[model samples]
Each structure stands twice: as C-alpha cells, then as structure tokens.
Target: RPLLKTALLGREIVYIASIDSTNNETKKLAAAGCVEGTILLTEEQHGGRGRLSRGWFSPFGKGIWLSVVLRPRFLPQEAPKCTLMTAVAVVKAIRKVTGIPCGIKWPNDILYQGKKLVGILTEMNAEMDAINHVVIGIGINVNIASEELPPDLAALATSLQIETGQPVSRRELLTVVLYELEQAYALVNTQGFDPILEQWRQLSVTLGQKVDVIGLNNRFSGVAVDIDRDGALLVDTPAGQERVIAGDVSIRPA
Candidate 1:
C-alpha cells in the first residue's frame, strides 16, 4: 500500500490473491476505463505468461507477480521504449535494496551471474497512432530456494534469497521497484530516450558480443552492435548485413 501510494499517488488500486495473469487483468481493467497508475497484484498466477507466449512459472507466495497499468500519451510506436525504461528501474531497485549486481538482458530479463532472476512482459492497447494503455508485468523470484525451482530452470534461475544467502522481504523489494519505476516513467516522458538508453547500456550484459537471434520467422547469428532509438537491438549479421531489431538472442563471448 505504501509502495503504490508513493508510486501512483491518488489512483485507483486493485489487489488479487490469485489470477490467471496480472497483465491480462490489468488490460481488462484498462478497457473498462481504469485510470492510469492502477496496479494489479497476485500471489499466484495460474496462467502466467512471458514474452513470446512462453509459460512463466509462478508458485503461490513464492515470488512477486504484479502488473502496472499506464495511460501514457505517447505514440504507439514509442511503447517499446517504456519496457527498456522499466528494466532500468528494476535493475536500479535490485541494486539499491539487495546490494547485488544485476545486469539486464535485452528486452526485459534481469540476470545475476548467468542466471535469470526476473522477467518483464509489456502489453499495450492502441488506437490509430496513439496508445490507449500499457500493462507492464514484472515477475521476480524473491525467496524461492534453489531446490524449489523447476527442473528445467534449476540450473538457469536464481532468487533473491538464493543469491544473497538470506531471505529478503518481498514487500521491501517491491516498494523499491515501484519507486524507481515512477522515477523512470517520468524521466522517459520529460527527458526523452537518451538518458534511459545510456543507463540501459551501462546495465546491459548483451552488448558488443556475438549473438544468435531466434525470432518468430527466422534465426540468425550476429554481433550485437547497439540499441536503436526505438529500443530494438541493432545487430551485424552475416553476408555483410545490418539489422535494427532482433529478439530472443543468445549472446556469446567475444
């Protein structure tokens, strides 16, 4: 409550103990004229989802699963920038609260060492040339022990308690994340993308490396060049090619 009040002052609030997906619920509320700054939270998500429709693992009371609804006046094309901004905010919050060094993978995965600790999915409703609303879903593994992770994710995932050698407060971490989110959101609207992009670059772990991009249509190998103004990744491909956007990339050491 304190976090939402600080991050979204004077806005309608919604809370749920269990939901199919926080992002989906946020979208429904937005379509029904829910105001900006409204938030939806759940302790367990039966149908939790990740980017590209992948299933997200969310156990009951084991992680932070929440979504924030926004009614920004930005153009539809600029929505991607907001996801990157959110990543920056999350990394900042993680560092501030836990004193752990977290790096952002392209798009919205937070990594520690080489394991994923959090994932963010952003969904938007748009009209012609303008955005109606955006629902940013954030999932963080807070107190889950290493033994509790799914077999597939056991070797590839870590939690706050696992990384920090002690349990951490989910409420405290969520508060820091929401506070940083408000700051980043305001900066993106007023200052532009450069500032956020710079912070993203500093926290990014995928830049200037060999990468294998696995997209919906095709897969290709490339060297990550930079992030464009619209936040799509720039890559240098084979056959002397250059591309502005690549998704699901596997970054390799140079």
Candidate 2:
C-alpha cells in the first residue's frame, strides 16, 4: 500500500468514505470552478450510475469509484473523443501495472476475458460552442471476489482480483491510470485525435468483429471496422451500411 499518485495538474483532491456518486460531487466542484485534475473518490457510491441510465452496484470499500474534472480546450463537438481517450488510458494502465491483458468495448467499458472490469461515464457542461469542463467518472472492479457480485451481474461483470487470482492494490492501479490519462489527454489536446485513435484501435477488441448495436430506432448487426475522429463507430451492415454515434455494442465472436 503505497499512496495513489495522481497527475495533480494544479487541482485539489477530495476523498470520502461514502457518497451518492463521485461524478455528482465532481460536477458540483467543477461548477464552482474546481481546477483541472481535481478528483473526487469514494469507497462507496449510494447511487452510482452507468451508461444508458443503468445503475451500478458499488458496495463499500470494494472498488475504485472516482471522478475527475478536466478542462480540455476543445469544442463541444470534440467531446466524445475524450471517452475513447479514457478507455485507452485505462486499458494501458491495467496492462502496465498488472501485466493483465485488457481491451476496450466501444464507448467506454474495459473488458478482460469477455467480462467488464471497468465502466466510464463522461459528462460535459457545454454552452454555445465551448465546453466549460468535462467530468469523467471511472468505476473499476478492483478487489471483489467473484461470489460478491450480484446474481444478475455475476455473469457479465468481473473484478481484477477474480481475473488475477489475487487482490490488487486500488491505490497503485489508480496512480497508473491517472498518469496514463494525463498523457493521453495532453496528446489529444496538443497533437490531435489521430494518434490516440490509432492507439485505441490497437487495444480494441471490438474491431473486425461482428457486433449488435442497439440503436434508437432499431437494432442492427454489422462488422465493426473503425472509429472516426469524432469517436463514432463505423460499421459495415448487411442492410446497406451505417455509422453509429451511440449505442450498446455487443460483440459476436467468430
């Protein structure tokens, strides 16, 4: 147990034993002009959220539930790319620190052995053409046992301890993840999305795989080919073709 080392980036840090949600706390601080790299972490989240309005199950002291506030100088249109950036950072950090192979499912779920180990939620307060700030919420299943998961999620979700056959230090993993996030964020802000997008493709497990994307109007099946600079998934569908900006992507392995 070493203490977590975050990017710091000139922002203050806040930690709590329990909270409604780290994202909610970070959003409030950001609205009050919290500096970049300000992080809110809690051991438990009473009302944790997932993508698509789903509620996440986070018990006390069993996971890494945290949110980061970032003020990237980019237009609102360029926001989705930040999700991709965070996904890449998480995957890289897991591999770097633990030597465990991990991959990204579209949008922002990190998977290992076809089970989700991480979930990311990104929110932005935008007006006109600019974004005031983005709150990136990251929930990681760190030290839980397989038997600890709820009956419904036991089949689809997994923890790092279950995959590694031993408990991992939450602080260590968080440090690495924050460092990687800062690096990727800087590259995207200074260089562009091309480099990060390329790296994202290399670490992605969904590309070239047949996937079912649950769209607003209807569901469609296609082969995921690539992701655009705007972070939209390009799919080659049988019924002509299409691009998906947002959806629940399910991979159908060959």
RMSD of each: 2.0, 2.0
Give all TM-scores, in the order shown.
0.93, 0.94
lDDT (Cα, tens digit) per residue for candidate 2, span 109-215: 99998899999999899888899999999999998898899999998999888998998988788888888998898898788889999999999988988887775
**lDDT scores in order:** 0.84, 0.86
* lDDT of each residue in 112-208, candidate 1, tens digit only: 9879999998888999998999999999999899889999999888999999999988888888888898888888879987999999999998887
- Which residue segments of model 1 deviate by more than 4 Å? 3-10, 244-254
Report RMSD for candidate 2.
2.0
Model 2 segments more than 4 A misplaced: 1-10, 247-254
Q: How much does candidate 2 score in TM-score? A: 0.94
lDDT, candidate 1, residue 115?
92
